[model samples]
Target: MKKNKKNFETKFWAGFEAGNPFEASDALFDFAHLDYYKRNLTQAVIYSFKEEICSNNTPSEIFIFYKAIGSFLKIYYSLHKKSSKWKVKEPVRTEDVFHLTSLTKEEYDNPFTVFQKAFAETAFKDFEFFLAEIINLSLSPCKEDWNIDLMSPYIHLIKMLDAGELMRERGLEKIKK
Candidate 1:
């Protein structure tokens, strides 16, 4: 099993290096043993790679990196779900995070649906908005309930994004020096 896993990883990288993203993605999905939820996540990565990485006409190396990441996220989410052991924890309500004075129907519904179509549809043009919506879904003030355990992956995503944003800002500041 370990050897098979290693070979799967090697084949994936080899396909990616050979400038065959479709092959790489197929190898990943086959070796991944993905469930319904994870398959959707994989679809998102593929869509992002095709739309953002390919249409932008990035270098092969950059494209491969993003491709790998999409696969990685799918794997990570699957493993994370498994490790959770299906423990039942009380969900933290939205009121615990924010005191909303009022909200329109759209405002109330948006948070719940932000991610519903993210993987299913490729219509979301604003990548930043899509990313922000993902993070916001993890954070409250926009939801009626939260499950810290189930939402762990999203919370970690937000932390990584925040750290990346800080590094980007600092890099820009240094560039101006």
Candidate 2:
């Protein structure tokens, strides 16, 4: 089979980051890849729990959302093989991104599926709605809904990203305290 050669490293996303939702520039979007995807997701989760949804979230609740975001990033990585890069660059319908509804027990796992379902529903509804759904799920994920385990190594990656960002912005004292 002849490999198709084309520019794929420049895929774009809305460049969501922690605290602020979108970047302030005329270009608008940011490139999409594993790291950016994870960061945007982490930011989305952070946005969800920051001040509006609830300020009293437990550490476990925050972990669940991070785990969920990590799981989705894995799914995206599995489907897309393009190398990760940052540039500036979406035509597919939203439903196409949410096509995990038919996976079986062997294919798809539990809490991750729950998160994915919530994400699919909220993804197109603007940041406010998206964060609301994420916060709700983070607060009370229906663990009974799925039978598979709910942990991924990506959770650690996300934690590192967030922690690094925190350390850079607020220093280690604030992160530890």
- The best candidate by lDDT is 2
Clash number by candidate, in order: 0, 0
Taking the tens digit of each residue's C-alpha lDDT, what string does model 2 give over 1-177?
A: 975433212212222322211121111122223355355455545544344333344565444444434333333332222212211111123233233333334223222233334334333223333434554544453422433222232243343233222222221111121
**Could you list the CA RMSD of all candidates, in the order they appear?**
18.2, 17.4
Candidate 1 clashing pairs, residues 3+ apart or interchain:
none
Which lDDT tens digits does candidate 1 get at residues 1-177?
Answer: 333231223234444332222244345444433232233333333443332322223345343433444444343333223322322122234443222222223423232122223322332223334443333342232332422232334333333222222222222111121
Question: Number of clashing pairs, model 2?
Answer: 0
Q: State the lDDT at 102 in candidate 2.
A: 31
Q: Which stretches of candidate 1 lie over 4 Å from their true place?
A: 1-10, 14-58, 86-177
Compared with the true structure, the alpha-carbon lDDT of candidate 2 equals: 0.33
State the lDDT at 33 in candidate 2.
Answer: 33
Model 2 Cα shift for residue 113 (angstroms): 25
